[model samples]
Structure formats: C-alpha cells, structure tokens
Target: GIKISDSHDEPELEFFDRVPTVWDDTKVIHGEVGKYITVARRTGSAWFIGTITNDEERKLNIPLDFLTEGQSYLAHIYYDDPNVPTRTKVGIKNIPVTNKSTLEAVLPASGGQAVWLEAQKKFVHPGILHTQADIKRTHKLIDNKTEPAYGSFLLLKEHKCSQPDYRMEGPFRIISRDGEYRHTKSKMEADFSAVYQNALMWTLTGNKAHARKSLEILTAYADSLTMIPETNDAPLLVGLEGLKIIYALEILKYTYPGIKDEDLVPVNRMFTEIFMPVMENFYAARPYTNGNWGSIVTKTYMAAGIYFNNRAMYNKGMDFYLHGHDNGSILHYISGETGQIQESGRDQSHCMLGIGAMATLCEIAWKQGDDLYSALSNRLMKGYEYVAQYNLGYDVLFSVWEDVTGKYCDWKTISDKARGNYMPVFEIAYNHYVRRQGLQMPYTLQVLEKIRPEGFDRDQPAFGSLLFND
Candidate 1:
C-alpha cells in the first residue's frame, strides 16, 4: 500500500504536512467491528478524524460535540467519491462548525472518509464564566417570561440594590489576628458580592443603577484599600475578596463605556499590587490548606487572569488547579471514583463549598477551551453526586481520610451535620454534566429540582437559575 507512483498520490499527502503526529486528546466517537468505525483525535486545538466501513456501504452522523463550546472551527472533509476527476476518486469540501454541529458521514462500500477541524477565533473575552451568547439566551428567556429563568429573575428582583457608601473614610486595612475584623471582612464580601450581583442584573435587565453601583464599589476599592488583607484565619477568610466583581467587570468593561480602561488602572493595581502579593503568600505558604481554600484562591486567579488578559496568570492558576499536590486540585479533592471529598467526615456544609468552587472553576475553564470539569474521569461530577446523594438523605460510600492541614483526622464516618440542606450549587453542575453532556445524575437532578432557580449561596456567583439553566 506504500506504492505511490508519480502523479498518483492524493492531496492527503500534502495535508499530512500540517498534521501533528502526537495528540493531546482522543475520542472513539463511533465504531463497530466488521461494520464501521470512526475515531477523532485532537492535537492541540486542531482535531482530525478518520472513518472506514466494511464491504457494505453505510451512513453515520458524527457529532462535533468534542469541540469546545461557543468556539468556531473550519472543517476540511475528504471522502471517497464515484465522480471525481482524480485517480483517487476523492472529494474535498470546507465548512465552518462549532460544538453544536454534526456532519453527514457517508461511506462507500469498502471506502472511507477523513476530516480535519481547525480552530478559529474565540469569543470577545476568554476565561469568562458566561459569554454574550449565554446572556443573550437568558435575555430571550426572561423576555418571554419563561418558567425557570423568569421566575428566578422575579425572585432576584425582589431584593433592593446595594447603595455602597464607598466614599466613607475608607474600606481601610482588613485585619484579623484571631477574630478581629471578621465582621468587617463579612461586610466587605457582601458589598462586593452585591456589586457583582448588581452588574449581573444590569446585564440581564439593562439597569443603569446596577451598573453604576458595581463601578462605584470598584472605584472605591481602587482608591481606598490601604493595605492588603492580613489575618491569622486569613487564608480561609480574605484575599482581596471580590470573585463576583471580577465577572461583573468582565461584562461591563467591553460592552459599557461607563467604565474606561484608564479608570481600570487603579482597579488593576488594586488586584496586582494590593491583592496579588497577599494571595501569592497564602497559597505558597499554606499549600496544606483545605480544598475549599484552594478552590477560592484558584478562582481569584481565574478572575484576575480574564480581567487583565494575562494568560500567564490564567495558566498559573490552571497549573495549581490541575497538578497541585494540595487538597484543592480536582485529583485530590474528590477521592477515587466514589466522589467522596476530604471534608466529608468533617462537615457537610464545608463540602458544599469545595463543590461550588469547582463548579465555577470548571465553568470558567470550560469557556477557555479547557475541560477541567471532565477532569479525572468526571471526578468533579462524582464529587457533586457524592455530596448531593448524601444531602438528599441517602447513604454514600465514605472512608477514613485525612485533610492537608492534618487538623481533622481518624474520622471513620461521613458527618451527618447539615445533611438535608441542599445548597445553591447543583444547578450549574446538573445543567453541564446532565443536560449538556447527557449524563445521568439522579441525585444531582433531584437536588436541583428541589431548589430550582437556585439563588445566592455565598461569596460566589449563585444565580445559576437565571444565568445557567436553559
């Protein structure tokens, strides 16, 4: 079969020059022995697929779902054809596609087809949790007074917008030697979360006040914060706590002219100069902290990375997220295939924090063409299932495990405290792994169904019913 005389080799030989020999990912896609088989492989961002059939001619539909969602790709397909001008009898065509597309896979008897999918431009902002398309979908749903999202919007609309008095003497130094400034820290977090929620409301409703409040709080932080967060309970408490505001800024900076790049100078300084050093010291010094801490810290980097367009910062966060040895890395956070988390023995509520953080982490990474959600054989999904199953009054497999801090150990059973309370965490996870990926998550679906249109859970983006569910 290696025989190729002059003027006989097909264009595939030329195409081979552009294809990589090694692949970053691979999927079986479709196949059957003695009948037909189709496989797809990805080298970097580009994907290549090959299909062949037996003696019988057959047809198959290959879904391009393996491609990153919301991203565009150019697909060049080469298939066996009966009416081709060349000796090889092959036809070639190029078309644009996304994760939403499917291809008509027609194979002649004993023939084959091959395709190459090349990546194209990304969304306006990368690493964002939600895109313009996502907001647009939510807008349409809300306008039509759709069930879940609209009902969720009405529930959210019942709350009054925050009028943060940023002009006060200062949001000065955040401090906690043992327990001091804990209340101040809580108040600060609530204010920023408010700022973020307001900005989100503005995006969904085009409310001027919501947008203005977000900007005003950010401007105040840029001008007022005297020193970085310093605390004894700080690693778990504060490190420039504004995870939500970062997303809010992501929405406003591009579409709204009210906040200018120059206005963000002080704001960026607030993150890099004021917040970054403290955050670096925390994870660097306390790699042995709880998984939830790692989750939030990694999330901070995700926000900063997207906001400043610092791929290095983004990648740095990703490095710890994937390979870090601490309890926070998804590999270590969720144990084995059982999805049992580190804090399972300690308390159910704390376990929810880790799961929520990962949901947001995976969402941000997924939009960036990084599928962290599916990491470790869907380990994060398993973690959610483990927690949700337990919270829904079901027994789960749990083993004695020690945390990174070594403070809580020798626990033999899962803690039953707060077992029945379902947090606002399952919506995004259910929507992604279950609805989008078509995976069955009975416990997760039950939990989400119990709390449809989940509202604010805590210091993170909590309005999944309004922002995530379709």
Candidate 2:
C-alpha cells in the first residue's frame, strides 16, 4: 500500500480492492536535477512521491487516498526534519484513510517531503505490524560492495582532476584549444561528464565530504558553460562530449541514493534547457559528416534520450545506429575532407570508444524496453570477441590491423605514440575484463590503480608475465 500527498494534487490512480503486491522494497530519496523524489516500491507496486523546488521554501500537502481506502493505512513519513540525527529518519503513524483523505506535509526551505505507506489487511490492521523487511531488502540491493564501488568509480573517481601532462598533448586537447572554438570554450567543458560520474560514485560511497566536493566541481563547470559559440569547426565533437557531461548528471542521481537536491539543480538546468536544444540542432543538421559518424552521434543522442526520458529521441538514436545510418554499427569517424566514412581502425582509443558506445547503447536499450537493442549490444560484444579469440597474440595484442592501404598491419607499428602505448593489451584484456568471463588485466583500470603497490599482480600469468614487467 502506498499513499503520498501534496497540495493541489489529485490522485491519478483510484484506490480499490487492489493491493500493491509488487513493492520495490527499496526506498531512495534524493534530488533529481532540481527536484526531490522519494520513492518506495513494494514487490511490483511503486509509490513515487516527488517535489520540485528552486532556491526558495514552499509548502506541500500530500494526499493519502492513493492507497486502498477500505483497509487500515499506516504511513511511514520521512521528511527533511531540522532536528534529527539522520535528517530523513522516518516516523510511523496510524490513520484511517478514505478516497478523499489528505495529509499535510511541510517542506524545507529548498526541500520537500516523501512518505511510504503500508496497508494492512482489513481484518488485521497493517498499521500495527512493524517489520525490518523493507530496510533489510534495501540494504541488500544497495549495500553490495561492487554496486557502490562501481557507482563511485563511474561517477567520481574516474574523473580525478589530476590533469596529467600526457593528456594535454592528445587530439582532444587539440580540438579544445586550436579548433577555432569560441573564447568561452574551456577544457572544463570537456571534463564535465567525468566530473559528475565521479560525483555519483562519491554519493554512493557515503563519503559525504567528497560527494559534496564533487558536486561543487560539477556545478561550477556546468555554470561556466552558460556561454558558448553557436558555430565552430569541431562543433560535432565538442557538442557531443559536452552533452555527455550533461547527461551524466542525470544518470548519477539514479545511480546513488543520497544525492542532495542542491547538488542536482544546476546540472538539471543545463541538461533540460540548454543541452537539449543544442543536441536537437546537431541531429537536425546532421552535423557530423553526413551522419556517417553515427557511432559518436548515436551514443551522444542515446545518452541525451535516456537522461531526459525522451523515448522518441532514444528510439531515433537507436534507429540511427541500427538501420538509419549507412554503416551497420553506430560508430565511424568524420574525415576533414569530403565527409567520407573513416576510421582510426582497431587502434586503442578507437576500439575502446567503439566498445564503450555499444555498452552505453545496450544500457539505453534495456531501459527503453527493447530486447533487440540488447541483442545488438551482444553482437557488438561478439565483434570485440572476434578480435580476442582468433586475432590476438601475446600481451592481448591484436592479431591483425585493417590499414587504409588495404594491407594487414601490426599493433606495434601504429604511428601515433600515445595510442600505441596501450594498443597491445587493450584489444585483448579490456574486452575480457568488461565481460568478466576471462582472465586479463584492463589497461585503463591498471593505469588508474598504478600508484598502489598491488597495481601489478605478479601471480597472474596474463597480467604479470605477458603484460607488466616486474
């Protein structure tokens, strides 16, 4: 049973003999973008109580008729109380509810209320029963070591602001600095997505201090992007990467349970109002070379669709990848001249970005209720596997490279030194690690874990002997 009330709100679904049999058993209350949503789901039925606030305080009167009225109702209310150890700790109260019953809840200066309702059997009042089941279940799903760590990794740690000297010399830097971008464009714009991904991780780890700091960084960067040039030489590249950061802000809130409303406000604004329009223009103009760069365009738009909950955009993005685009796969590079479909071709960063696009699209497909998208993602994984099983040598290096001259090439012979640094092991270990079905060390994970002593495990043959030298 679920009952939530807000002032000037009407119950959408009429309560009847129907009992909420499917409860999510998980309750997450946090600000999503500029709003706070308190959700309590049991089995399959979910009671989503949400409030949107800006920089000011407001009052909301939530109603109780959303729950079955004929039966006894018990509401466990958790508001942002000023005087409490855990600010959101709940209080239970027994109440008889009818179709017209309503409850008044006071919201904070910039916060609001969230409630969980448990309905009891008509014969035996549910108000009297207090069980630790829901908390336990929430803990079970959320407290897992990997889930929190994964969120932390994706949200916060992955984008550590160290800004190594090596990264400054990359193509991305060239695009940012010398690509004829407007003076308003900055490197922070490129780093935004990475920043919020870190913030989400920080929120999940219960590292409140670090989480808050991450949010501050994210907010500041987002705020700085308020001004950007409308036209640029590399608009497609910059716009897509910029949109990625904006989109990350949306996914981060859902990935972590404790994200505050204040942290999400600025991020939400940029994504909903600012970035959406830019993306629409990009898609409409077919900005990236006759849309042959579908891989990058599709991935960027897919993130846009999922983050904004725009099913049409999501479907169109997926369609672009699957059928609309010239190439079967969604990823292709834009040539500076003649808008031909070019590829870096099995290079380290190129392959990883390719796989990353597939991984992201698969996640979106899962969310959009399309099983075929799921299958395409699998096919992509298989495509990566084709490189691993037959086309791999020692050190997880590629067996063959598809050079532009139509001649087979070797990984060691790649011209770009920075990309060449990781090519050998990348095509091999990275794929295996992502799938978690084989024993190989991912170069990126290993690189991030570099400063630690256990960074290189000598015991594992694949990691120790083939790749790293002790």
TM-score of each: 0.72, 0.44
lDDT of each: 0.74, 0.40
Candidate 1, pairs of clashing residues: none
Q: 2-25 in candidate 1: lDDT tens per residue?
A: 554543334444346557878898
Q: Which portions of model 1 miss their true places by more than 4 Å? A: 1-127, 161-170, 173-178, 237-240
Tens-digit per-residue lDDT, 1-470, candidate 2: 43444211111111221235544554443445655444434544334344546666766555554554464444434455444322233232223344466766666666655454544322211100101232233234345533322232332233444222112211122223233544323554335433533443343344555444445555665565453345543434434454446444553454445577777777677655655665566556633342223455566676665565554565566545543423324322222121112233334444434443444444435334443322322344444443232222323322233332243234443223234233222322343335334433333344324321111111111111111210
- Using lDDT as the measure, the top candidate is 1
- The local distance difference test score of model 1 is 0.74
What's the alpha carbon RMSD for model 1?
13.9
Question: For all candidates, what are the clash counts?
Answer: 0, 26
